[model samples]
Target: MERAQPLPSYLVHRYQGWKATGYADNQSWYRRLAELGQHPRAMVISCCDSRVHVTSIFGADQGEFFIHRNIANLVPPFAPDGDYHGTSAAIEYAVTALKVAHLIVLGHSSCGGVKGFHERCLGRAPELAEKTSFVGRWIDLLKPGYERLGGNDADIDSATLEKEAVKVSLENLLTFPFVQEAVDQDKLTLHGVWNDIGEGGLEYYDAKSKAFRPV
Candidate 1:
């Protein structure tokens, strides 16, 4: 089958420019990274959204972060179910092997996974029920939060659901033995961050303030 769309002229020009200058600008850094291996100071768990590029957001170069991306940046409670635990396994390696000092769960505005959970819980979209797929199974992790919201169909707002989902994932992170041990032993600090793309603002979860505040 043919591709759905052709490359835009502007993007095609930019891609050509990148191909010409990228090697000169990036090759040395990549070579150094290869020689040094990764010694990232932080491990960021972010959503796998093309718009939410973690490195660009943080102004980071290659090898600056040990990164893992998943739907909604959700971290499920650790379980040995003989299934693929991609996110959990990455976290384990980042903590135990790389020994990163910080763990950041990066949530963002207009998250599809969070929105899907809200709709699923509220039963707003019955068609979603027919699509039994990975996203559906993944969002099931947020069921407790959905129940806690009292099943009031009116309370299923996207913003509220997204914020609550961040908290849920933060709590779920503690369920992992490696994460808990790291936090208890003062080896790592856990943080939840919400990026508002519309406002170009970042809100961080403050334990003392008990709310997400601008950073």
Candidate 2:
């Protein structure tokens, strides 16, 4: 076997230029970040997909959002056990240590993870049985949403499933002790967001409208 090649010429040149210009400021940003620590006012739970970048989509600056990214941005109910619990640990730190006031679960269009979940449930992709070993276990948190669909799984569109998964994650967030406590004390708020990749639009869950509206 052979190792992969280095980056292309254009990318290398562009990266070098960005490194030169982006870092030429009043001070080195990395040092400032280390000194200031992350004091983000809000925590955003988003997918690990490269296309759904939280900072780029929200136009957020450094230290603006304490972010946690995982497959499908799913937050499982609080459970203390042998589970790796990467997302839960980040949530604990954000809520208990950072004490962020707002927690946003951002879902985007055409999420591959959610599509994988759908396929696993529908038995279309058996190879997913091995690949989804961990992801399938995590996505079980959305079992209620699957039940809520209450129709032919084939007829359930991927977009609809993706949106429902966000709602499921929001519901699961309440299961966390720290998050529940924060919400009960009126110290934390939960938001569900849908980001449209094609149109560059953001739709937030509107309680008054009972639908997702432009944000």
Model 1 lDDT per residue over 1-215, tens place: 57678889999999889867985688777788889888999999998878898887889877789999999888899897988999889988999999999999998999998888777666885655566667888888878877777655455767667777788888998988888999999999999999887887888999897788889
Angstrom error at residue 197, model 1: 0.7
- State how far residue 67 of model 2 sits from its true place (Å): 1.1
lDDT of the structure predicted as candidate 1 = 0.85
Q: Alpha-carbon error at 161 in model 1, in Å?
A: 1.3
Residue pairs clashing in model 1 are none
**Candidate 2 lDDT trough over 10 residues, lowest sum:** 22-31
Deviation in angstroms for 166 in model 2?
Answer: 0.8
TM-scores of the candidates in the order shown:
0.87, 0.87
| Residue pairs that clash (backbone atoms under 3 angstroms), model 2 | none
